[model samples]
Target: MKKLRLAVAVIAAAALCPFMAKAQIDLGAKAGLSIPNLTSGSSSNPINSGWSSRLGLDAGIHAEFHLTKRFSIQPEIRYSSQGGKKDGNQGFAPTPEMAGAFQQMGQPVPPYLYATYKSEAKFNYLMVPVLAKYHFGFSPKWDLYVAAGPFVSFLLNGKNETSGTSQIFADDAHKQPLPFPAVDFTRDQDIKNDLKKANFGISGHVGLAYHLNGRSAIFIEGGGNYGFVKIQKDAKNGENNTGAGVVVLGYSYRIKNK
Candidate 1:
């Protein structure tokens, strides 16, 4: 009877070990700024100009599972706003042969014309990242950590806005010119159909946290996300991948292990 009772107690403790381990989970929320850009493809040029970085927002919730004294696995779900901007000037002039042809056709050619163009593309995505983190202790109250892993993002919405001004000149020699109306216009359109629905990337970050006690702390982190998959749906239009640099400030709380 004594041997049976001991055996039953051991079995009950063994069965509770997994559940007890999971009670050590930590939860946190983070919010910050992200600078995002679309990496231009080989086809990007003066005509189909490349993209530049734009400012956006990043916010997320994460769960961290401690595996050891100095290591943890963190999984996060985030809302990220990302995109790029393009701004520049382009000029066009009539060739001599073309000018002559226009004259023969009773249509005088404009000697010179130039346009200043500006455009921005905005994309919103839901992203999930699973990271492996290693912690380094500077003191009992301060710790530093570095994490890296893979992330998958789903595009929620996208838009593109363009504005430009074009001025036409009568002739290079005659700067005073005719009464040709300058063209100025702005257009905003939905671009979801033109972009890929999903994107996959590698993300990594380094941060420092200060422990207030055994349960809570504050942290700051800087990280970069680089997408390997193209974000454009049609490859023929040229490849454009997502890239972002982010900085976040957050607080975390550890749940007591049962």
Candidate 2:
């Protein structure tokens, strides 16, 4: 998107601005675990509600400009795995054939059908964040730091994976079935078309680092990102937001300008 590109350009310009002033720059790479959840909007739609977290992986590289000993600016590009899963009885739209069959029996087609199933929605994204970081010194070899900033992300892919089988139900509350055979539910549903291309949000972290030498150190950090925008392009597919918590182990090397 034009707006996302412009924002990225601004961040890149900001990173380069410190070069003329002879600032310290650090390059780093990190890899870690991601725990993602889909926060649904207020709705009775089963697709929009009742989601649980799924485990995935995340990784990235960053360039850090030291504006001062205690403060710095860091820009990062990261890959995030996000989405949610649900198991057990869930609701779905009724097919025309199902409605016709039920209608002939003097039974009106309910608004939806219920079945026991398993579903997992996985979404992949490429994210960029411009962070302001501050370091706190408590020991000669270990330092603590915190960083937070705004980020923009682009969706690379999305899908819904479903499995299991159950008899069709008119109502889950009363355990009423339509006297139908058990239906197979295993399938991969491509959801990329249902999602927006670009998203913007916030990212932050609290980290502790141990200095291996004067130039390089290893660190462990925990943080999270949340999308301010809804992911679904259609309200009918379900209104949901992308969010995840991340923990990473990373290494950084400083290129000191002496």
Candidate 3:
């Protein structure tokens, strides 16, 4: 994590080097919705596979330095909400008792225990993205721009929350039941320890801005982010990647150079 952080800082500093002396710098803040999902790379691992998008909060503050009339460099510190959801019947790892019962009968243990419930894996991350932005001025008051860059994220928190009342079964066919009592899947489990702390990814944006004055502009944009690495520390948990689609509204103001 320290190495990742150092790399991001060095990259941002390198991007800012040439423009510092003359470019106009703008400071801004934005807030919006994040629609995040986990990509379950394999179907065979039922315990950590099959998930859908979940709503989350995305917000950030950034500094943009204009390098030319149409180009700029922007580096940001952002908070991202990520993860995915699964509903209905899902698989759980078998317990010791479950494995022993199958063993006593001279039967091989099944890979998972079947349960009908809902699971939402929630994650929070602090991200930094250094971007190259280009703007098209259509009018004195309006401009359209797009940006793309690589980002690094440090995980702040992660939790597995489950909720439902479902029968536990030793097989997907529901013919075999475990001896455990009625199962209740309703609790938040801290999963941060099971995940790596830093992630590397890509993020991009496309939007339009309306200049409110010579020093300020208001804009709305939509963007997306995808992490290149798997999220789990142990391969047995399943290989899942993180990503999100986002929409936000923001305002930027140039600082006076006096």
After superposition, the stretches of candidate 1 with alpha carbons farther than 4 Å from their true spots are 1-23, 41-49, 90-114, 167-182
What TM-score would every model get versus the actual structure?
0.75, 0.88, 0.89
Comparing 1 and 2 on lDDT, the stronger one: 2
Lowest summed lDDT window (length 10), candidate 1: 41-50
In model 2, the clashing pairs are none
The lDDT of model 3 is: 0.89
Residue-wise C-alpha lDDT for candidate 1, range 1-258, written one tens digit per residue? 979967985896587557547647889999999999888656433323457899999999998878677887788999888888878653334447647756787885754444556778899999999888999987999999999998989999999887886554443333643344565637897989988898888888999999999889999999989888877776544467788999999999987543
Candidate 2, residues 76-174, lDDT tens digits: the string is 999999999989888777778788888888987777788889999999999999999999968889999999999999999999999998888878663
lDDT of 3 by residue, 1-258 (tens): 989988987997887687765888899999999999999667878766778999999999999888888998899999999999999878887768768878998989877789889999999999999888999888999999999999999999999999999888877777887766777889999999999899999999998999999999899999999999899998767679999999999999988442
True lDDT of residue 213, candidate 1: 94
Q: How much lDDT does each candidate structure score? A: 0.78, 0.89, 0.89
TM value for model 3: 0.89
